[model samples]
Target: MAKLTVERLKKQFGTSIAVDELTLEVAQGEMVALLGPSGCGKTTTLRMIAGFVAPTSGRMLLGGNDITRVPPHVRETGLVFQSYALFPHMTVAENVGFGLEMRGVSRAQRGPLIAEALGLVRLSHLADRFPKQMSGGQQQRVALARALAISPKLFLLDEPLSNLDAKLRAEVRTEIRSLQQRLGLTTLIVTHDREEALTMADRLVVMEGGRVRQVGSARELYEEPRDAFVAEFVGRCNLLPATREDDERVRTRGGLLLSSRRRADESSSASTLAIRPERIAIEPGHHAEIKGQLEAVTYLGAHTEYQVLLGESERVVVTRPTPVRDDPMLSVRTNDPVSLTWDTEAPRLIPETAKD
Candidate 1:
């Protein structure tokens, strides 16, 4: 395993800037996930590290050796693409051993390495089966085994689970996490799925518009987003427009008072309130209450989602988990008078300058 580092890596295509002065590090045996929407430069950054795309400027180093200009084959990194590029004509064993073959490993010595790689992905029994004979999950595991057989210093995956179904995605998610931990591989994954990145990565690197937005553990980003983009992107959040009163007070522009969850910086001009849907209570409580009409209700089995039209101008959404005893919100319907409230410290004060 090796520590990977990139310093001010940049990539530009004509008038379009794909990545802008990106800098980050992955310690030995650490897994970091890069998350963002399409065209956010996540994939371009990964390709730069893999040596498939040369950086327009800046440097990349693996274990202190500069490999910014190194060719892909000489970089010694294993890559698993979104599409598992296994040869349909080759058997599983042949597919996994292709990397070794290209590196000129003796034919006699490749058997044990192939078997070990297959065993790691729990596909040793299907080694002789062709790609046409295996399931999608099995095929993906074979691709992973192929990458592992080369004993790469850094393991890079680009949306490794996007092709799998929901159930298969969950199963493979657990499998990939466990496999990475067992091998202690220094890995970097590029994904647009927040939940996937949160569950798999030790730390998250969120990006947008060719720049880094925030870097933190999953819980930190979820609980205390530094900006409005992060607040709404990491999870389901409502950014209510608010007017500031002195330094400690704020209310919705529509005149609903809300307590700030976090203390704002003395220099900050907080003009918005950020709150998660699940944090709001369905009924009146000791906290600040606001009246609205329940415009829509969606029964999502474990939780019910309500779109409340506050007065005639604002809308606040609430997601409440189904209770074992009873939830009065269940009988509530559209246009009904709904009283919603939240604890004194549930909403966050977002400064106007921090929103992106």
Candidate 2:
């Protein structure tokens, strides 16, 4: 395993830039996820690192060696493609040993190495099976084994779990995380799923418009987002246009006053007050700090989502655990008057100038 560094990495197709001044570092034995929506350049960034796509400008270092111009086969980076690109005619053992063969390992020497890789993914028994005969999950494991057989300096995965069913996806992700930790592998994964990133990565890099928006742990991104876009994109957030009224207060455009734990920095620009769905509390009466008309109620199994319209236009979603039998909220309906309140520290002030 090796530490990977990218400096001012950029990629462009003609006039359109796919990645813009991207810089990141992945520590040895740590897993970092590149998270963003489709077309945000995450896959492009990964391909650049893996030497599949040449960068327009910038440098990449692996274990203190400059590898920006290295060929893909010589980069010593194992990459698992999104489609699990396994040759249909090859048996699982042959697929796993292909990388070793490319590196000049003889057939006599490749047997134990292939067995070890397949064992790491718990697929040793299926080594004789072909890709077309195995389930999707099994095929994914075979691809992982193939990548692992080469003992790569850097491990890269591109949406490795996207094709699996929900239950299988969860199980496979857990297995991957466990194996990565056990082997102390330095990994970089490109994915658009927030839950997958949050649960699997040691750190997350959130990207938008081909540039990084924020890089931090899941808790830091969710609790202390730097801007409106990061605040809303990382999770469900209620963003209302407001002007800073004081050190701890802001008045929303809809004529409602709210308190925030963070004071807006001394910028006079319009700001946004961000509150999490579960932070706001609602009661049956209209006597609280803010009153709103309940617009809709959605039962989401473990939790209930309430859409409340505050004043003329501000609609906020508040989530709470499902109430027990005889609870008054269980009987609340749409269009009912409700009182909303929250602790002074529940809301955060973010610059409204952040563009999507």
Residue 207 accuracy (lDDT) in model 1? 91
What TM-score, computed on C-alpha atoms, does each candidate reach? 0.93, 0.97
Q: In each prediction, how many residue pairs overlap at the backbone (N, C-alpha, C within less than 3 A)?
A: 1, 0
RMSD of each: 2.2, 1.6
Candidate 1, residues 1-356, lDDT tens digits: the string is 89999999999999899999889999999999999999999999999999989899989999889999999999999999888889989999999999999999988899999999999999999999999898889999999999999999999999999999999999999999999999999999999999999999999998988888888999988987777777787899988888666444577888766565446452266666888999988763223357777788888898988888875678888998865466555566687787887775777776544643
RMSD of 1: 2.2
Report the Cα lDDT for residue 327, model 1. 57
Model 1 ranges with Cα > 4 A deviation: 261-270, 284-288, 323-326, 351-356
Model 1 scores a TM of 0.93
Query: Which pairs of residues clash in candidate 1, taking residues 3 or more apart in a chain or in different chains?
Result: 261-347
Candidate 1 at residue 231, lDDT? 78
Q: Stretches of candidate 2 above 4 Å error?
A: 264-270, 353-356
Candidate 2, residues 114-203: lDDT per residue as tens digits?
999999999999989999999999999999999999999999999999999999999999998998899999999999998899999999
Cα-lDDT of candidate 1: 0.86
